[model samples]
Target: TQGDSGIQRKGIILGKELARSLGAYTGDLLAMMSPSVRMTPLGIIPKIKMVEVVGIFESKMYEYDSNLAFISLSSAQSLFGMKNRVSGIEIKVDDIDAAGHIAVVIQKKLGAPYFARGWMQMNKNLFSALKLEKITMFIILILIILVAAFNIISTLFMVVMDKAKDIAILKSMGATRASIMKIFSMQGLIIGVCGTALGCLAGFTIVPNLNKIVGFIEQLFDIEAFPSDVYYLDELPSQIQYFDSFLIIVFSILICFLASLYPAWRASRLDPVEGLRYE
Candidate 1:
């Protein structure tokens, strides 16, 4: 089980940019020195080690990109002056979905003095907060979509009014109430699909690059970049999953259908004689 993956220094990985910033590269000599905290007659001491940078990787994440610095496992052991001992082992499972099951299995197998951790366990709080925020934002923005769907309802209602005579004649000719309802419902659905498609396109395509877009806007408007300090990240980060888009479309369709239902029912139930008499 001790393959290339098990090799690490100070129980961490080194990212490429960080390694470069530290004036180190792969297979090069680098030193990690930890300062001693003590008030003694002899004064403070330092723990240092000459280590080799085995690999340099680049993770897109800002934290990892800026913070990761590497040293070999053997160097870490020698630096800490701990022989035949390791802080912990990091494992990547084949299936992330089965992380809990695999962790339990590994725990049972390894028993005491060993443990397994999954990505969720490491950043559970962060991921949970992200999910909650995404849900909240989605719900909030969906009001805009709902407002757009209402336009469909308004359009279909006006269409019903304009074609009242046609509706009455159709009713007299035995056109079922359900059929009349279907016509209006279909009109609402078409509008809903169009609006939702436009919204999703704008959200997914443009929102991800919100920072660049905002930069362009700032240039146009002659303003600063919207006070970047407010955001935890320098730029907006949006990951529009297909699943989210699919749900957006489904919800839009449902809203449109619901919006059309009441008006459609009213139009269908109108008395043909009375409706014709009005005209």
Candidate 2:
């Protein structure tokens, strides 16, 4: 309706981007060639038909917008000289997440001659690549946490050395080696807990406002950090999953606990006499 007044018997609809690129408008006639051949005086030639443009649609996705075209099923069949036959059927499901399951059921019902495929099956390679990329990024980020854990280990070891004299006095006052170990381990655990909480807080606060932050930085520097034309999006997109955040916090704390092991063991094994030799 937006293009031509109504869908004519041989009407075709063009994607918005395709229409723009071809400088075509509603009520304009476009010629399309079919793969089937027609015999003519000169020789065999491809079948051709001139169809009126009835509508233009926008899908937002660049690939689909620039490439897809549509026409009535009957018109399509007639153009290809396959009257009364359809190449495929499109089905809409209420639950998109169960599309694969539904596709399986459809295939089972259709049996031998027909097959059904879900969108996920149709784009398997793209999803697999995305999954691999996610795994690689996760491993890389985990390395950063490991590096921080090492820093924590060094800091705790320094603290243990500085408090050696106090530890010796505590031991002389009847503090057990187990109690000394517990003290150092608890101190390390407290540090890990605090660091994890702060990191989570900062992540939650920053991720949602990342686009705004980038915009501010761009304004300050007078440069575009992410150009809309190149990226095909007006702003950067980010999502914070609670489950992922929980896993990160757990992993960081686990690493910190492991890092504290050597330092805590060394502090607990310190002999009172050796620790207080110069005191």
The lDDT values for all models are 0.74, 0.87
Tens-digit lDDT string for candidate 1 (1-279): 111344455343466557667876555666668543445688876776565666666655656755766556676667777677988877777888888788888889999877887777778889899899978998887897778767777887898888899999999999999999888877777777777778778887787788789888889999866453333344566676788678778987889888988778878987799779967
Highest TM-score against the true fold, candidate: 2
Each prediction's RMSD over C-alphas, in Å, is: 5.8, 3.6
RMSD of 2: 3.6
Q: Please, what is the TM-score per model?
A: 0.68, 0.80
TM-score of 1: 0.68
Q: What is the lDDT of residue 142 in candidate 1?
A: 85
lDDT per residue for candidate 2 within 127-195, as digits (tens), equals 898799999999998999888888989998999999999999999999988889888888888889999
| Candidate 2 Cα errors over 4 Å, as ranges | 1-11, 24-29, 42-45, 51-56, 210-237
With candidate 2 superimposed using the best TM-score fit, by how many Å does residue 30's alpha carbon deviate from the native?
3.4
Stretches of candidate 1 above 4 Å error?
Answer: 1-31, 35-41, 50-56, 165-179, 196-244, 272-279
The 10-residue segment of model 2 with minimum total lDDT is 226-235
Clashes of each: 0, 0
